[model samples]
Target: KPSIAGKLDNIQGDIWSKGFPKYYETYYFFSIKTPLLNEKNLFSQCLKNLSTQSPRLISTLRMVREDHNRISTRRKEEAIKQGIPEKRVVLPEIPMSNALIAFTIKGLQAIQAGLQDDTSLRLTDVAATDPAFFAGMTPKEVTALLKDPDQDTWDPLFRSTEIHGMLKIGGSSKGKVEEHLKNIKGVLKHGTAIDDVFQDSPSTPTDSRVDGWTRPNDRGKEHFGFEDGISQPLMNGIDEQEPGTNANTDVNMYTDPRLLIVTGDTKRESSIPRPPWMENGSFLVFRKLEQNVKAFEDLTEQWEKKGCESKEHMGAKLMGRWKSGAPLAVVNFYTEDSKDPDKAKEMNNFIYENEVCPVSAHIRKTNLREDLTENDKDPRALRTKIIRNGIPYGTDYKGNENNTKLTRGLLFACYQAHIEDGFQNMQVNWSNDSTFRTGHPGQDPIIGQVAQKSRGVNGDLETFFNDKFGVRQSVKFQQLVTMKGGEYFFVPSIPAMSDDLGM
Candidate 1:
């Protein structure tokens, strides 16, 4: 038997055990050219070309080891130079460049069929079992199921074009990422035996390219001026402690590895057996959400006028956390994020039993902690756990709340074993459901969408500011975050890509 680290080396993309150093990233969505000449052998040859370039692809285990080596090397150099022990030396995190690739249902079908002659070839037997994966993201039924906006409002590439696959390249800077992307395109074009097999459409205005990056100067904060990615679930085998924090003591924050990976021993409510080809693979959900900064600020201002304590309080209630990454469940008033490292580590060590965080708050709705019965809490947590790996895109707001010209928001992405029980369940059953557990806590004020409505409805968005005073305030508002476009993809393990697809 191989170790978990060795197995992870065969899995492409970040596993969220340790977050990737992605300061900047470029997402390239392209379609495989139809009517492929010699389609039988052409597709396999193309995959072989990609497999030969595997050395350029970063695996989850390689990322962890490289990050560890970088830190250790820095500590050793500092110890020698300063005449101190290595344990005493501390350094800031260093960023690294990486690349990953994933295929949509259509792409996988095309590869499996080997020829474009058969339109009936389906991946239902050999691929993922989730119906959401088989039914692409833009279908009318899927839109209604997920409470998404009309397809007409989405980017043309995602709404109409048939996206076969995506190539993601990330680095410490924009220039480095761009250079790497150039190299990847070159390899795909010339190295492959087939020419023009995978090409971006020329008719599209956006060129099927989306650029993303962390907010400059203020790292770890989203365009909404709030700390993001603070309360991620800690995997059992891949991680011993939560990054940016000390050892995770909260039982609710830890997750079993079986919940994330596809193995023969994996068991779910569904009867479908795990495919051998997808042993270590995971389902990927990609969404391009555009945030309206000025509109959110304007709404906060309106709430302040309507008996709310303050704009910061209203924002905190909506998100379940202060802008400084401090959870409202643990703290009272909003203040500057603590500069002390010890205080920052304690931020993610609380549950929602205190009622300080609203039931309708974005985080609370997404991850319910101890809000249900003892028996239900643990089971529900296991069902909805997802590893979020996303970043901010576009520039920060420039003071004008009404400027529609400047577009900025999150390029949200998450990985999970089962799509139906994970992201979809969180969106449809939790976030969008007003009467989720106890109170009529309305929709998630930030990203939750109402059926057939262009905006969100927070019917009972309420929170208790002062527990002693018994003062509870509620406010209603429309959603600020809008889903521009998205898709569901299956990222294969490196071995599967090389042996199965490349064959």
Candidate 2:
């Protein structure tokens, strides 16, 4: 038997890889709408294509190993030139094209029913034990549970169509990703037709695909000008072996491997027994969030006019971090992010205390970070942990206050073993709940929703404009990040694809 880490190729790489080479990506959603006579044949052909291409899927373990070797070689070369041992080397950015495939519950049932010899068998016979996976993202009940806006407000493609599965294609450049997508489309052309395509930073008029990319030169920042993808949970087997040890070793940042991987030894005693096919599989939560930058800026300007705080300070208080990725709880001020490498590494180390970072701050609301003492005995933190692999969609706001035509936000995707306890719990139980920790801290200023008219008071956040000024005030923020559309998917292991799905 091999260690889980050794079987890297078995799992979908996007679930583990920080964010796939992410210069550009195309999330191709497809439906199995072939005629009954050709349904099985079409499904099999699509599965076969995926199985054959499984080897090309980027594996995080393999990626880490390759990066480690590359860094070591680079360090040796630098050391030789300097005539001394190299202490540090700037990490090289990997440029590569990759693809990941995941399916909705209906898609899995369709595939199983199409391929399985026994036509009498049902999805329950081979279910993964997650009720949410079966219920999906569009149901009125699920929408209400997630506290998302009305389904009617969502994009027609997501609200009306049955999205069976998605093929995520990403690479070093738009051209490279497009080339990869073309080849993929060509391969699956005989058996399948893409129902719709969602692109990152879509260029043309006909391309209705949502656009996303790392900001040019300013890689990690989103359209809101806030640094993103920081403070990720460090998994036991994966992050420990990765090149960077300084930040990964922090116990506060550590997350149980089972939270993101399907394993028998989960901390939840009441957890349902999962099928063998779900061994390395993980649940993927995909949300297309559209940000209203103009409205947010207008609100910030109004706050700045109050004379209690500057726009920069107010923004950091809301997000719990500066634009440079420095946590307000750690750096205590926005101007403290002075391009120091050592200071940058210390960003995720601090714990929430005395509301140094407001209790309702986006980061604090999403991750309590030692705010609850029960974390030592039975950790709620572990249950809600999710590995985010999202990217900013659209372009820079260009200070256009009235431009509704240019949409920009995040293609928010996260991986976790349990959907109910992870993403759903964070959004519903924590983010939306005003009195989450202690006191009426209000909803998460960034992602939290009011959910109902009764909860309207919870929508306004109370925070100090400046702790030094002692000018505490309540600010009612409009819904800035809108949930346009989304879906839940199951990224199955390679073995599952081959043996169980009949690839």
Candidate 3:
């Protein structure tokens, strides 16, 4: 049997290569009903349902396709020149399903109950479990085999890495959406006309957004300041083999490489031949990264008075993008005349003759036009592709009277192959590394960590300055973004679930 990675047609949309748009997320877990969906056609029916998707997910699918095709084209050119046959070519493509997220404990239970009526469910008895495959693998190896190393392995997957907990779902009105989910749970409750495999239910009342869900803690304003999700590596036609490792910096190998290429030469060695359930399985990670509103406000205000009038422009400089997603590395601060200023202009188009915006600004730091010239970093941002899917978790911004300040921040979710190498390492080693840009002092300025050795105004945060050049620097982060709780989850392919592990 071919490995699941070779089968893109069977996996869930958000589970593997495909990612949902940035929004609040939720995870749903369900159990099979006793009578279960008719095994005679269970697998076929499930796959059919997967073909149908929510509207938002469909748009993201198109973007993923474009990226996949782009990467495929590049890889094909490279492979042809290298003498590889066209038939053996591998190009990465997005997975079909977007992994599901459930917001509360009740949400998890609700999903479990829904499984009772889920015709896609199958009985454990007659499912295609293979003893030889089981014998070839241990519990640990089986778990690893279930996850593709090349696919994005952040948030949703992080949540699954835990023994228990529910996924948080997002949308316009989170509280209202949560209630709808609870209502579904009631419909599926046991013996009241519908069947229940996981529980009798009705004992647990539905949960509401009013109760409020707490956010995660591991985020901060990258040194430059504007909320940053600025750059990410897009998928292309690259082999699944380990890309050459960088030697100059220390790399947390496990965390950095968390993405899986569903359409390319991406491959992983399963202890045994892949099963149907395991095909095209991708991991998804969701996190609620809260940004400090007060801190950002104060910081931007201080910088604005210093001859920079556009707060949005300052954000672009700090985030590498205008609120509209345009890169400041291209357009100037005052030139609002450009018809829709959101699209990023090409590098050759930008006039860098004048250093009105310092060359070492946040955008310039991460993507120095020359791939090999500045800091010798690869110019291609594909290595850092992370599908950011999150939302502003707290209430709308209010004035000073609201001291508690809406528990505001970004629901920072990213999808990458390795956590340590992708987001964590990027923050610590790349973006935060003050020494990355040669001859430039301080950090990336936007996401760079301001440490004891950090370049702050006055002697560190130790001394006070009166009207001095350093004293003019009034911007500093007061409220900060933090990560609270999350886990790594593996979205198993249908074959891996049914035949390999019998999940």
Q: What is the C-alpha lDDT of each candidate?
A: 0.67, 0.67, 0.36
**Index of the highest-lDDT prediction:** 1
* lDDT comparing candidate 1 with the true structure: 0.67
| Tens-digit per-residue lDDT, 1-503, candidate 3 | 12333334344334323233222334333332322344333322332233243332212234334444655576678687878744235444322222332212222222233343432222221122222121221134322332111113222323232222233343323444455345444433423322322233446433111122223231212222333343433233211322321211111221132333231112222233333333343333444444555666665566667654455555554554554334554555535532232233222223234333444455555444433223235432334334454444455444573567346554445554433323444455555554654443334444444342233344221111112122322233422333333334334443433332233
- Which residue segments of model 2 deviate by more than 4 Å? 1-3, 34-41, 54-95, 117-122, 125-128, 190-209, 241-255, 261-271, 338-342, 376-379, 452-467
Better of 1 and 3 by TM-score: 1
Give the per-residue Cα lDDT of candidate 3 at 283. 32
Q: Which run of 10 residues does model 2 get worst, by summed lDDT?
A: 243-252
For all predictions, the C-alpha RMSD in Å is 4.6, 4.6, 13.8
TM-score for each of the candidates: 0.85, 0.84, 0.51
> Candidate 2 at 350: error in angstroms?
1.6
Give the poorly placed runs of model 3, Cα more than 4 Å off: 1-8, 15-279, 306-312, 337-382, 444-480, 500-503
Q: What tens digits encode model 2's per-residue C-alpha lDDT throughout 1-503? A: 22356666666667763445466776767765542554455655655665666435434445534544565677678777866644333334555676777889877766655653543323563344677878899888987887787877787657744578777776667777777666666666624543444333345422334547777766667877877776666655555433432332223345555444444324354445566566677888899999888877877777778775667777877888877667788777546462333355456666766766788889888877674446674365556778788888887787844766778889998888878777988998888877776777877888887564434474433332334466456787667888989999988776677565533
Ranking the candidates on lDDT from highest down gives: 1, 2, 3
2 or 3, which is superior by TM-score? 2
